[model samples]
Target: MKYLKNSTDTNYSMFLTNPEVICRKIGNGFFLLSSKKTWDKCPYVQQISETGAFYWNLLEKGIQRDEMLDCFLREYNIMREEASEDLDYYIDMLIEYHYLTKIE
Candidate 1:
């Protein structure tokens, strides 16, 4: 909700990648963890799905939420409603985990 208003339009411009957050490709999935610079209780290594890693890369590149949706729609063959719901849930989870920060 903070980063995305809806699937069609959004108020946020981009997500801020935490300086302490590190990401890596492990086989087919991704490995995510916080760096020593961050004292927060981030996990040592949180594994994510390939789809999740795809979105993570988009976020890491500072893509706007709406633009992310566009990319998602093009990359996957799912319905827009389904894609929107999935994206919203993923973004919300990332926000909760402090993996990404929203900007307006």
Candidate 2:
């Protein structure tokens, strides 16, 4: 939790801010679709893993990185470093693809 504030300029402080993205669940996974205006810029539809879907659900509700870590700890028996690393990669992917916006 202490890292939450200290990590402001780091990836760990970012939160999802995109609202024009759409996600639909299909067979225990989910597919993300961006609005038509955004589609031309980022054309690929993203298919996410179950864990990624969980993260996406949290993002849709405007969750923060520490909250993601908390959820990971509660749901999985993983180390904090591992959870943080994975979350960073996942969030980076979403942000890179325009699926999730990073809040400053």
Candidate 3:
């Protein structure tokens, strides 16, 4: 599968606030706590499940998708195919919500 550079992700300046949420500015995207409060304010916020949140946290550290998929497959005791499908679905949702952007 093809992957875009981290730099192609969207600028999330409008979505973040509060120091306690623990945010890290990556190339363009940011990884932050998916808290209820944050979700409340940005109703469009992509609501990721716990597993999805785990991958998001890892991505913040510059981990790539393959590595994250490997970890999730091992940690969740799931098949690689299942992991990939879930990952793709959530990532697409994030993109659709403007939390992520493609590098055109």
lDDT of each: 0.71, 0.68, 0.53
Model 1: CA > 4 A from native: 1-10
Greater-lDDT candidate between 1 and 3:
1
For 22-64, candidate 1 gives per-residue lDDT tens digits of 7889777788878866646456678987778878887777676
Residue ranges of candidate 3 with Cα displaced over 4 Å: 1-46
Error of 1 at 51 (Å): 1.3
Tens digits of lDDT, candidate 2, 25-77: 97776888667778755645778777887877777766666886798789988
Misplaced by over 4 Å in model 2 are 1-16
